[model samples]
Target: MTARALRRRAPEPTGSGRGWKEQTRRVSELCLLGIVATVLCLPVLTVGAVVATLSTVVAHWIDHDDLPPLRDMGAEFVRRLAPGAVASAAGGLATLVVVRQVQWLASGAVPGGSPVLVALLAAAAVLLTVVLLAVPRLAGGGTWRTAVTGGWHALLGRPAAGGAALGVTLVAGLLAVLLPGTVLLLPALLVLALHAVHRALVPGAP
Candidate 1:
């Protein structure tokens, strides 16, 4: 059997356990990273943002072929902003606090490391975890626990694919930092959007 195929068959525990929560947390962390990258790489990420924005429409279109063309998925995003804003603010603050605590604890070992930067990165990680876990729960589709477990299985079972995904995320993040004025952010957004589309379009991506 191919290595990829073997990874696909890893014996991942399904939604029936606490393992799911961890999975959800990581997913949230990943999403948080995307958001940070988008904001940081604003000017250059326009195309990517547009692509990601479009992916939502495409996902719906694929699910319901008879759906109206050009359905304003964009509009719904705007509408949700009010609610998302509250949630995001709360989430961000909590993340920042916890990350700071963690960094302070780590300071004893990492002599000269910047606690602020570490804390910020840690908060981003926590934010990703929280978002992934919380969003799915709020959507009423899956518990944060279920999404985490299922999502991790999706990664663990496909090591190569999972690694590639991390690679894409890292490169996109780098573009956000290195070429803040470039179009890479849009591409990054598209990559994310394409991922969403692919999963939705596929029969059983997860």
Candidate 2:
């Protein structure tokens, strides 16, 4: 089959036997993917691409029942290495700036009600929302500029869906902190949530 055709093909519903076997196979596959994603994200710089690729894979699974091979996932990680590293660096820089600002505010260098503080917070929120949306867009393939722009538009166009994505992130974070053992399950859960959020908001998702 052509590459495009392969990309578009759906996964068969497990074996031709029992339904429970299919469920077991699906769960096992997701766990394997999550393990691969977790190990690949260890360097921090590849986090963005890892997430984007996982989001794309899960989105395809949810929307079309298509599951690409794990090798494809690794290939995507390598393919997106440059852009992903840039994105990771930008995110790290932004986090550092926010931390510095918070420290300044705590030290009383910046007044609590200062307009600058408000602006910073607003900018951070906007950036977070855009980043959340950008993953799915990047997974779909295109220039980072296009993904970011589309992400911003998606956030503006569907605030509810955007909020859902944020909620998913927050919930995953809380679970990780509250139940450290749950961290292993988080990768799959987060990907599923992202897929659901995008499927709900994107027209003709299925």
Candidate 3:
């Protein structure tokens, strides 16, 4: 299909009261097949394209009927993609470190012989946390360095809430797909369920 066809947002759904919910349902239904198809054929699509598409998906979930088409969103993502990407990569790295630390602490282990390891890890964590600041500015304007200071404050402001949300998302995303026997399809079902929840509250999200 053409890019336009591929990126078409779902029509406004039938409902009342919750404009955002209805919008979410509509977009979810609209993109369900395409998303499934893409996920199935993930090897065929470039990771960059998938990342761009997912960014559009995220934006769509946040904004409903008025959100721009996926094509335009993709183009927009291409224009200023570094900030969010860097933030995301850095965040992922941080998550890894946090997880590893938790594992270490849980193991009842003490400091290792590699004394420099702790220092290096601490420095990396500091840098990683700093990168989050640029994520907001990456949506439009802001220097990569400035994002560090701004992000530090935002991080402080929303620690608990962000932690809870991240915890839930990680759990749900992990359970989104399960494989038992030849195919149980439980994980995919879970993903759909999570998507349902996402659609309900997320604007224009699909």
Residue-pair clashes per prediction, in order, are 15, 0, 7
Q: Model 2, 1-206: lDDT tens per residue?
A: 89988877956554444388677777777777777788888999998778777877876666555577768866877788888788788888999999899778767787874667778887888788777776677666655678778778888888887788888888999989999877776796687877678778855443
Cα displacement (Å) at residue 14, model 1: 40
lDDT at 23 for candidate 3? 63
Q: Could you give candidate 3's per-residue lDDT for residues 14-54 as a string of tens digits?
A: 44545886667655553553454346334432422333344
- For candidate 1, write residues 62-146 as lDDT tens digits: 3443222334645644444444455445545776777666676566543545665576676565445333322222222233345
- The residue-level lDDT of candidate 2 at 63 comes to 55
Poorest 10 consecutive residues of model 3 by lDDT?
A: 179-188
Query: Worst 10-residue stretch by lDDT in candidate 2?
Result: 10-19
**Residue 16, model 2, lDDT:** 43
By TM-score: ranked, best first: 2, 1, 3
Off by over 4 Å in 2: 1-21, 63-66, 111-119, 203-206
- lDDT (Cα atoms) of all candidates against the true structure: 0.46, 0.76, 0.45
Local error of candidate 3 at residue 156 (angstroms): 1.0
- Reference-based lDDT, residue 204, model 3: 38
Best candidate, lDDT-wise?
2
Which residue pairs clash in candidate 2?
Answer: none
